[model samples]
Target chain A: MLQNVPTRQTIEAAHMLIAPYIHRTPVLTSAFLNNLSGTNLYFKPENLQKIGAFKARGGLNAILSLTKEQLRNGVTTHSSGNHAQAIAFAAAKVGAKAYIVMPENSPQVKISAVKDYGAEIIFCMNTPEERERNVQEVIARTGATFIHPFNNYEVIAGQATAAAELISDAGVRLDAIFAPVGGGGLLSGTGLSAHYFSPGTRVYAGEPEGAADAVLSFRSGKIERAPYVKTIADGLLTYLGDKTLPLIREHVADIFTVSDTEIIAAMQYLWERMKLVVEPSGAVALAALLKNREAFTGKNVGIILSGGNVDLARLPFGKEV
Target chain B: MLQNVPTRQTIEAAHMLIAPYIHRTPVLTSAFLNNLSGTNLYFKPENLQKIGAFKARGGLNAILSLTKEQLRNGVTTHSSGNHAQAIAFAAAKVGAKAYIVMPENSPQVKISAVKDYGAEIIFCMNTPEERERNVQEVIARTGATFIHPFNNYEVIAGQATAAAELISDAGVRLDAIFAPVGGGGLLSGTGLSAHYFSPGTRVYAGEPEGAADAVLSFRSGKIERAPYVKTIADGLLTYLGDKTLPLIREHVADIFTVSDTEIIAAMQYLWERMKLVVEPSGAVALAALLKNREAFTGKNVGIILSGGNVDLARLPFGKEV
Candidate 1:
């Protein structure tokens, strides 16, 4: 069933609830990037957000909105990315136990960050069925509420605030705003905010060619898995959620699919030119904008840099052709 | 003869003169860093400045302060670093030709940046005598006015504005301000600004142990060269100038020498936590502060990150043992 889409008022409430916990991340601009892309780009750096991703907003909101009984038990989620850190951080804030299940092969950096947040980790096999089974076991054992990374209503409401801020803060009207689509949490939230707040501002999604499920879903008006999932954008490997898909289909103007090489090159531009330590997923929106520059030329563009949690030792810069 | 120190009014004027040409550069802080270091650090990221360094402030001030006839003849400088790109960018802004004398083995990233700014490159052997000879040749051929990298009065005035801005913008009064010393242009300027603008705020300098001349000069009451200079802080290889030493002795509280290991570690913290892409030279002051965290335990500290122009292909992160 498609969940009821959040009202603009619900997002405003979520913004107030999470404001003290999350950073009012700066909207950064680059003249060099603007000149290169032939568009004025306003980058809202969520990489500088707590837990180094936009996941902080949703995670904080979801945990903060939980009932006292729910808090008494704890919160649990299964992930191997920024969402895990976000959940751990948010749970710790409320003095609740956070039990996070993760893929056995998660990056050491990410595992260490979640552990640092005092989250109890339960390793699972790297598959949807295995992750679900592990989460069910954790919930059954601890009586903890499972916080869905994106599909939850409160989490979607929380994610909406980032775009609401941009729409309200950007001095001029942006022609379009682009964000990377993973589980469609951020992209769906961004689409909804842009639709309700500034109806004229079109929302766009940048899906990795390796994880091209969102593009298929957008075209077919339903959730569809990619032909194959193999991209450097680790944060964006998930297909769109059922709740997120309908909102995306309604609000997103288009979804652009970019290659891994394009994502790495865009990451390099952000690292070298803008001095931002963005992850591959954080750079996908920018890669999308640059790849199809003609469509955005001379337009005031808003590119939401999603995260900055890459293993610095293994930067894909040397892979640049 | 000791050079007359620039008054606060001179720095104010430099701030106004170069306001259009340079980024005011944000004062950023990380709670994670504050908790780890046991002190509050306000980072002025001049790495985001035009030409990607604080040298833009000095170079632009020097060129803009020049007479029309001087600009008509053009400008020249010797640097294999940010200063080369700064002079090139500054001269290009004023429609004057810039002749930069750089070592033959200068990094291609910096070389290409200078070239991108339309500067005429004259390569010299990696020796002080050869560099001087090349600058002289450039001056003899182009009839360009030689803009000394750090030892000039106007350059010092220009560099002072960064600290002046930090003091004015930081809301809370900084207990102390720290900057890395190369030829002491930025340090002397910072010292003079702090002494005049906020008399209670102490000034300190961070010098690479590999290029530890400033510490000796501070003690001996005269300029001195390092016993043997070798450090990854490539921007801080030069000793203090006659023009800069007197101001340092008058205004600076002390100089701290740090190893390359400390510099890289501090840089890693900035990259991972604060998400700033700082170069080795830029991280030196923070290294000094971190190495001596106890002394600044409760103090509000101001750290000037000088530059962020680094070769991405050759990041020294692997040497972090």
Candidate 2:
């Protein structure tokens, strides 16, 4: 099943296909952060990407790859976060209707974002089984193409474009690239990009300590599930998918698990020093680097700021000066 | 006194002088924002500038313009905001001591930022008279040169670099540019840049309704002071100076006053759509544009995001998810 998966060529093609739609988001560097970590860090700010996340890349690529006949009926996905907005935005851009199945308890902010993109909302129970069932039902009823958030080959290929741009835009070889792992779409895509475009660059996954399944699976050489998922990095709550696991195992150098406290601190650092409004999951990669500063000291590191679709009202540090 | 003030040539020279020290901050565009305003808006994100404000440009240029004899004694400034950090950073870069006179009520976060840059802190009462007296005392004791936050010629020249970059970087002739006016440094500089770099472009000043001194001054053809300052845009509380007034009158096209509520709403809009962490002062320009959408419909407009040095703990929107 993994043999026919997306390679470097697929990512390159996706990059071209989505070039007109997406922004080549800027690469920002902070002297204060560099001095603190003793590393030359280049941040690929996908937080500034379309739909405020790298999910836009994958969503657009997947939707654009669909046949005219498939697009005629529309597309459907189940997500309570950035991917839902990504699909809605991508579908709108491609002139296709999107039916998004989100948990009823989804944040009003995320729900409104999807609605703003003109997607039809289908609310379901807050469980993987319910979401999957609802997504299937919608697809079956409408004959809409089901675009998996992070577990599909084309989505993975689309995500790889971010890393491709990072390397080419930075115009320097990165010693290591770190990305947050949730369903592993970004991490796997990062790995493939490093493997193909900049072979010498090592790829690492930053996982929340509460959701350490990705790290455990990478170490045990088997698929693993989180015993419990509870972290302020809300975007990294999901476990890895089968499509992403093999790619991570083959090309990823290591997986680092960081506590919620560390994630918050990294977010604060980004907010204060870099003046960037990155969401918790977006700061995970920097959290890992800051936690293990010795490992990346004096090296050129590339960090992917995954997204910035944060609930401003519920900031981690609370609402007080 | 205004006769020897900075012109466009001085701004171009300042840009060259501070080229190595300051960041040529990025100009970001949002399709979402464009659609909402019905204008093609280009955002000069000076919030990402060193010290998290365009103040860095003026502070650095002012400090660097000092003679060796002046540098030997050091620099002094009275500021409780981004200007304090800017002077500290600029002094450090120029290998000179910075004596910063900040109010005792200054936020701890800002105080720490100044301290971190190795500037000597002199606390005074939170009043203009007290701040001035303390700054004078510091200058007398250290024989340091005073770098006025926004009134000085070099500082005005430094601020103009942002507009210069925007016009050149965007590679388009803007119909008009909007900049928030506090002491009129940014607005004056923006006016000068438009006068020189983009001759056909018009410069508009965005003033807080609570601090409408600039707008009043513009309308009356004379300097004016705010009767009372009470706005979320704390950075724009200061009145315009003699040096800045001359330049503003000579080059600025108009001034628009926006209410505090509108400023907060615009700030929220930028946060949601642009994923930018701009302070209240930074949002004032966008607020004016949004308020008078008819004036700029389908026209190319440039907005200068003045800074991002807000006390994050006390966000405008209450802490309720």
What's the TM-score of every candidate structure?
0.96, 0.97
Per-residue lDDT value at A104 in model 1: 97
Per-residue C-alpha lDDT of model 2 across residues A1-321, encoded as one tens digit per residue = 698688678889999999999988988889989998999999999989999999999999999999999999999999999999999999999889999999999988889889999999999999989999999999889999999989999999999999999998876789999999999999999999999999999998899999989998888877898877889898998877889999999989999999999999899888766768899999999999999889888999999999998878878865322
* Model 2 spans with C-alpha error above 4 angstroms: A318-321, B319-321
Residue B206 lDDT (model 1)? 90
DockQ of 1: 0.55
Candidate 1 lDDT at B198 equals 93
- Backbone collisions counted per model: 0, 0
Native contacts kept, each candidate: 0.57, 0.49
The true-versus-predicted C-alpha distance at residue A79 of model 2, in Å, is 1.0
Model 2's DockQ score: 0.52
Q: Tell me the spans in candidate 1 whose CA falls farther than 4 Å from its real position.
A: A1-4, A319-321, B1-4, B319-321
- Report model 1's TM-score to 2 decimal places: 0.96
